[model samples]
Target: MKLLALDTSSEGCSAALWLDGQITERFELAPRGHTRLLMPMVRELLAERGLKPSDLDALAFARGPGSFTGVRIATGVIQGFAWGLDLPVVPVSSLAAVALSAMEQHQLADGSGVAVAFDARMSEVYWATFACRDGLPAMQGNERVCHPENVSLPDPDTTTDGWFGAGQGWKFVDGMPEAIATRIRSIDTSLVPRASQVARLAIPAFHAGQAVPAEQAQPVYVRDEVTWKKLPGRE
Candidate 1:
């Protein structure tokens, strides 16, 4: 399968091309540079592989629960690519991508529990737990946005390695429930979702008929409702 993936769901901007079984990627920690960096990364990845947008069989992306602007950027880019190329798209969770990335980087065993959290602004976190299965992260529960103290943890008895934490939200470890804090064997504060992992997670889903039309693919924002106030005298 020749799939292209991109992620701009955090401070990082990345793009990947998964050809057959090998993957190549371009990534950078660019806080507000995604709009500029993302397309070039995609173009370069395809160019390096001696391919073009038409050569891709499908597209995938890290879809949400990170910087709101970042999530929108990735979603827009992937949707545009899918529409123009007439390819299917798979939206992988931003948290799931981080969890899978951590699992691979740490070489966690099957059944190892991974709890991923993104420091969602406004004193809350975007969080979820996953269990490593066959080198992939299978979410254990619904992803949510909540105060650090209310984030969920994996069931201790079910995982082989207690629990490991990943993402900037782990920076709030002191605020998390003690029950969760005590179970985490380690945490990676530097970790962010990447396109390579997004592609890896998407491969199985793509084959399983999870890929959708560009118009059908939508971003998943755990905390969906947003409130805004009109600017003074600017009705």
Candidate 2:
């Protein structure tokens, strides 16, 4: 299937074209510049594939548990593109993409496990523990927003050790709770959701008749509703 996917859920903006199992993607860590970079990246990706918006079988994007503006930017762009072409769209979880990428990185087979987290920027982290199955991430615990201190490890008895962790969220955790620290033996600090991964992950959802309306393709901002005040140099 030919699919176009994009992600603007963090420090980077990324877009990709996936056709016949081949993938072409563009990504950059442009921070607040997502507004400027995203569309161009999408255009370039589509242009390289010699395809128009209508040629895509589906459109996919990272649907939050991330930056409010970033998630909105990603979903809004997907909405416009999908709506314009009258195409279906798949909304994949940003944090889920993070975990999937990590699982792929380690070649973790059906029995290994990993923890995924992302610094939520308001003194919290978006966290989930997954059991890696043939390199695919299957949730082994709950997905939630919690302070570093409140984070707990999943039951070790239910899964084997050689625990791996991924994402930038772990950096914010100074000294991990005793629950997670003892078993976490490896960590990959450089992983984040890329447009390529989002597209790859969305293939199943798109083919399974799981696509949603453009307006319903919204974000999953897990932080509290209280607006965070920032200084001129902040935010």
Candidate 3:
């Protein structure tokens, strides 16, 4: 099966092509240039592999819970491509991508849980928890947008030692609960959702027939009111 994926839901913009089993990807930390970079990256990846939009089974993308404009850029692009090619669309969770990255980096075993939090800016975070089962990160609860202090495990009774924290939210959030903080084996602030991870996660969904029409593919901005203004001297 061949699949194409893209993500611009964070500081980075990335595109990936999954052909049979081999994967090819391109990623860039273009906080303000996703619009210019994403399509070119996609075209380049496809050209390198001699694949066309119609040659792929589906197009996948990180749907949301990151930068508002970034998320929209990905959603809009994927929707346009899918709509034009009449292909199915797979929407992967940005947080789950982060969790998957952590799992791959730490080489965690099955049954391990990961808490992924992305700095949502405006003193808030987009957070979620996932359980590593069969080498895939399965979301434990609904993804949420709220203050970091409000972040907690879906099941408090789950073994804390099995939990890990990841993403920039940990860096911005102050005074995290000791119980949660101590249990996290490590926290990676540098990780951002990537298109490669989105493609990997989409494999199962694509086979499971979880894809939707391009028009139905929408961004998942957990926050209701996404209004924010940039502060002076802050990028």
Candidate 4:
């Protein structure tokens, strides 16, 4: 199966094309130019593979739990492309993608769990946990947004094998509880969700008949509601 995927959900912007069983990707850590760079990156990958939007089996994207604008950008772009090509869309979780990256990059063995987190600004984080299954990270719990201090694991018994901490959120927080920290084998503060990883994760979902129409494709912003309090000197 062939698939095209893109992600602009963090400081990085990336596009990946999965043809046959091989993958081609373009990635850039551009914090401000996702809007300008995403399409070109997508086009470049397609061109390299001599494929078009209509030639792909499906389109996938990192759907959310990162920058609001970044998530919206990817959602809108994928929606438009899918609508135009009449193709199914797969929305992969950004946190899950991070976990997949950790698995591949760190060579975490099967059954290893990963605690994925992304700095969500405002002193909060977007976090989730996933266990490696068939070399893929399967989410263990709901993705969520909260202060680092409020973060906790599902259950010690369930995660006793421990999880590898991945993403920038772990860097922002002072530290996790001793129990949790001790369980973590290691932490990768430099990792961010990329399109290549999203596509890899989406392949199974795509084959499982999980794709949706363009209009039904939605971003998963864990923080559904935001409340703001005006500071004394600010509006």
Candidate 5:
């Protein structure tokens, strides 16, 4: 399957192509450059592979809980591509993407848990926990946006030694409950979600018939329900 994935959900802007089973990606830590950089990265990836948008079977993106504008940028771009190519789209969770990326980087075993948190300004975080399942992240609970002091593990009672914390949200660990902090084996505050992991997480979903129409694909913002600002052409 030929799938194209993009993620602009954090300070990072990335585009990736999943060709058959091999994945190729271009990523940069360009905080506000996503609007100007994302499409070019997609173009470059497709050009290097001698493929066109029509050649792709599906599109994927990190759909939420990061920078509000960043999520909208990805959603708009993917929706436009999906409409033009008449392809299915897989909306992967930004938190899950972070978790899977952390798992790969740490070489964690299956069942090992990752608590992902994106530092949402105003002293809150976009948080969620996931367990590595067959090399993919399986969410342990609903994604939420909450104060660092309120952050938690879905199953704190379970063995916690295998759990690790990831993302900028970890910067606020000192404010979280001692119980939750103690359970985390360690923390990686430098990690950001990438399109490579988004593509990795979307492949199986695409194959399993989880891909959806462009109109049905939407960005997920875990906080401020009434304040969402969508990209142009979207209601």
Candidate 6:
């Protein structure tokens, strides 16, 4: 499956082209320059693979609970590119992408349940729990938007057999209970959601027939429910 993916959902801006079974990725830390840096990465990846946008099987991106501007930038770019080329698009969750990244770093198998958290700023974090089945994250619960202090380790009393914790948020907080921190087989803080990872995720979504049309494209802004302002309507 040939796919192109982009992620600007944090300080990182990354792009990738997945051709046949090989992957080519480019990433940089441009905290506020994604809008400018992203397209070039896209162009380079496409050119490197000797392919055009139309030759791509699908477009993928980081749909998020991270930066509001970053998520918009990613989805907007993804939509513009995918729609213009009339290709299918798949949106991967920023948190889930982190979990996937963690798995890749540790060489974990298909059954490792990963607990991932990204520093959401404002003393809060964007967190989620996921398990790998065939090297992909099958989230245990809905992604969460919560404060760090309010977040707790999953109950070993009920969830999966083993768990791992990763992402920046894991490092931000202090004194993680031993039960939680110790359970972690590995911690990869350098890992962040990247477009390349999202493209890798699209592989399954593509064969599963999960790609959505451009007009139906949406952002997963877990932090906001008030973006739709009180309209000029009965209030």
- Model 2, 53-118: lDDT tens digits are 878888899987788888888877887777678888899888778878887777776677778888
Better of 3 and 6 by TM-score: 3
TM-score of 4: 0.92
Alpha-carbon RMSD of each model: 4.5, 5.0, 5.5, 5.9, 1.6, 3.8
Model 5 lDDT per residue over 112-137, tens place? 88999999998999999887777788
Off by over 4 Å in 5: 156-161, 226-235
Provide the overall lDDT of each model, using Cα atoms, as 2-decimal numbers. Answer: 0.88, 0.80, 0.86, 0.86, 0.89, 0.79
Candidate 4 per-residue lDDT, tens place, 7-49, comes to: 9999999999998889999999999999999999988998997
Model 3 misplaced regions, further than 4 Å: 156-161, 226-235
What's the lDDT of the predicted structure labeled candidate 2? Answer: 0.80
lDDT of 6 by residue, 1-235 (tens): 7888889988999998888878899999989999899988989998887887878878888888788888888877877876678888888888888888888888777767788888877777888888778778888768887876666665674345577777888885464555566677667777789876788788888889888987656788776662522112313
Instruction: lDDT winner between 1 and 3, please give it.
Output: 1
Clashes by residue pair, model 3: none
Candidate 6, run of 10 with poorest lDDT: 226-235
TM-score of candidate 1 to 2 decimals: 0.94
Candidate maximizing TM-score: 5
Cα lDDT, model 5, residue 131 = 79
**Candidate 3 local lDDT, 28-94, one digit each (tens):** 9989989999889988998998877788889999998898899888888887788779999999999
lDDT of 1: 0.88
TM-score of 5: 0.95
Q: Candidates' TM-scores? A: 0.94, 0.90, 0.92, 0.92, 0.95, 0.89
Worst 10 residues of 2 by lDDT: 226-235
Top model by lDDT, which number? Answer: 5
Model 6 vs. true fold: TM: 0.89
Candidate 1, residues 1-235, lDDT tens digits: the string is 8999999989999999999999999999999999999988988998898997898999999988788788888877777788778899999999999998898899988979999989988999999999988888889979998999998675567787678999999999999999888888999999998999999999999999899988766677787695222222323
